[model samples]
Target: MKASVKKGLGTTIWLLSMIIILGGALAFALNPSPAKSIFGYRMYEVLSGSMTPALRTGELALVQITPPQDIAVGDIVTYAVSPDGTTVVTHRVVDKTTDSEGQTVFSTKGDAADTVDTNVPAAAVIGVVRGHIPIIGYIIGFVRANFIASLMLIIAAILVVLAVKNLSAGKKKKPANPS
Candidate 1:
């Protein structure tokens, strides 16, 4: 009978994976977006006139759509439209009325818009503008668009795959084949 034990790079990779997963989970819960240096969702450069004075064209807006329950009044939110349409509407909540069915409906309108928007179902909200870096979001967006982190991801994938293959191969081989 042959017995195999984890060793060398395999042990290192396993330890690294455990550390990373646990570390990421801890950081995600304790550390904020800034502390972790990770944005929860895609951000875009405002290219529309709707946001106007508040968020001029070319200004960066970090967008992340969450469930209706997360939507709050006065939150700058973006919503998606049906059929390949999307609106980067940044507006304050004017009013909220709950339906008899236990659903909360919020009305929001952009600062520059003429009237309150179509009743924004609490379901349609993205997220609050927690913080901003003025023009800095654009730089981050450009880097992501170009896949600047591609190399890091590729290396991580290779390491994981090699570790898995080596670990499995170690288990299958007979002791007589040791070399």
Candidate 2:
């Protein structure tokens, strides 16, 4: 590929990555829910080491909303404990049974915890773990906890990357000589 074309492609890729990163940051900030299932899966940030070895703090979990009946014992799931569905907890299902009202309920526990979480309603279950992305949760948490600072840092980094690319691209261009 030509130098200019290669440079353009690189710039495009960088911009696209920044867009995705910033968009995610914005979504996290605006949404009250921990994981909003966008496109079939919800992205959640692990805040504690409760599920360590399987999931850790600073990692991101991609969970897919599945029927409570479909969730079997030993599956990791994200669930809401709050009435408004804002507060969420991610843990492993140790047992499953129906409640007094004939409602499906689950007993969940953090892998690293000493005790089990009693009776999590199926309605509160948000999703089952589908995959994990390491280290992104830290970034999300940092951005959420320090919005302005993170935004400034992100903007500054983007500027630096673009500036460096532009400088390198300029250096590669040569002046035409008169015949």
Candidate 3:
């Protein structure tokens, strides 16, 4: 291959490598699973504007699973809202009190709401918000919703890379004479 072509291909490969490395690192850092909490914080994607001002919809929130006794009235917590534990919500703890059975119950509310939500048992609480990243949650949600399309795009990218490699390899193999 000509020097100019080699230089162009080298630059393209370097750019692609950098993009892949950085994107993977960013995704891993912002969306860590329970088993991958290197920073001791769990990441959640905010799905509603209930916690607006402090945490907006489409944002990424980092939370830590502190003990129930450690939680204070003003803390923002992620908790399951349904009996089946499928529906989750994030709200500020308005009150903390023990029930008749001496079990701790939390009265939570959205920052934008005028009233507290239904009391949430301590066992239903997932974690307390430590911090948040603006707008990263939208990308994560989109990828999850359109997983098939994303997979197709990834496959297309791999095919393109393989085709380029084959073309370059073929260029390096030429007959001794054209005849």
Candidate 4:
């Protein structure tokens, strides 16, 4: 490839990478709740082995908001475990039914669990799991727990890359001395 083409390609890649990193950092910083959704999707870090063999611990689960009436048995879902909606759990819906007041209730169980969990109300449902990425949850959890350190590390990495690039450019621009 020509030098100009190579340079342009490199610039484009660098710019794209910066946008991704900075955008992620900004999102993380501005997140108001643990269950906040982006573009109608929410991400949850699988924290236990309950859903193992399907959704493993350390994997990142992508969940999409779904109406209670739309949920069916056998669909994996993430729901609030506490009344305050502070704690969340992801499991497969083993049964679905309506309660005395005609409210939708779902009984969930882990893939590896021996028994099903208590019935969860439709109001507590966060979303249905759409997909997952292995090990990304661990990285995201670490960064979120250490936001300041992660941000500093990212900034430092960017600086080092820029410095190295400038140094190399400077060397390439130096005129060759005639022997």
Best by TM-score: 2
TM-score of 1: 0.47
On residues 1-179, what C-alpha lDDT tens digit does candidate 3 reach at each position? 99769966986797688669756755675442433453667677799888889999999888887789999999999887777655678899999999999999999999988888989999998789999999888877776678667657766876787689768867887567767
lDDT of 2 at 175: 77
Lowest summed-lDDT stretch of 10 residues in model 4?
Answer: 25-34
Expressed as tens digits, the lDDT of each residue in 1-179 for candidate 1 is 22334455556777688668745543443332321224555454565657667676556676554566776677777654443334445666777789788888888887788988888666665666554436654543444455436435546876787778778877776477568
- Arranged by TM-score with the best first, the candidates are 2, 4, 3, 1
Tens digits of lDDT, candidate 2, 2-114:
97688788889979988897877687555766556678788888989999899999899999989988999999999998888777899999999998899999999999999
RMSD, candidate 4, Å: 4.2
TM-score of predicted structure 2: 0.82
Error of 1 at 154 (Å): 20
TM-score, model 3 to reference: 0.66
Give RMSD to native, each candidate.
11.9, 4.0, 7.5, 4.2
Lowest-lDDT window of 10 residues in candidate 2? 28-37
Reference-based lDDT, each prediction: 0.60, 0.87, 0.81, 0.87
Name every residue pair that clashes in candidate 2. none
Better of 3 and 4 by lDDT: 4
